[model samples]
Target: MQLAANKGFATEKVLNLHEISHSLEFYANGRLVRNDDGRQRKFQGVSEVIEFVKRNGGERVLVVLPLDRVSEMNVDSIEPTFIADNGALALYAVRVR
Candidate 1:
């Protein structure tokens, strides 16, 4: 989160790829809200998630998963912009193409 902030990316523009449950919390309209309902979209794979992000005006993707899982993602439309020292977290910039 701090890295994205430092890079001047809006919080709304960064897509979290982690599994989100009903306990997720975020701010909407300047108020803290909880995702009690399972209304959040879940993607079957990384490709779908990237497409969704592109459709929704998002430009960045934050991946927090094992290296093997990351390797299985279709990265044809995105490129790595930042990678953590532990190789567990990565930030990708979505290509316009």
Candidate 2:
């Protein structure tokens, strides 16, 4: 979430979907389900992230921290945020074409 970090959405403590219990992860009948609590915690979860997509409606989520933060998770399409875009160390966070 390098873009999110650049945009000031980064958290001091970060966790991904694989790290949490499946129950905490939201899945909608083989699809992604949403969870409101994801955005508020130090660690972000799949269900919570799914919830963000619902409320935000695919607006644009930026990555500004580390690629590994999301590498193991399931997601597609991310718009680059300015700060992360400007950072030279952000190449790892960019989606490979």
- Best-fitting candidate, measured by TM-score? 1
TM-score of every candidate: 0.51, 0.29
Model 2: residue 43 alpha-carbon error in angstroms: 4.5
Which candidate should be chosen as best, given lDDT against the real structure?
1
The local distance difference test score of each candidate is 0.46, 0.34
TM-score of 1: 0.51
Hey, what RMSD does candidate 2 come out at?
Answer: 11.0
Q: Please give the lDDT score at residue 53 for candidate 1.
A: 61
Q: What clash count goes with each model?
A: 0, 10
Write the residue-wise lDDT of candidate 2 on 1-97 in tens digits: 4444465544322222333324223311222222466332322544454455445544333222234554433345433323332322222222211
Off by over 4 Å in 2: 1-43, 64-67, 75-97
lDDT (Cα) of model 1: 0.46
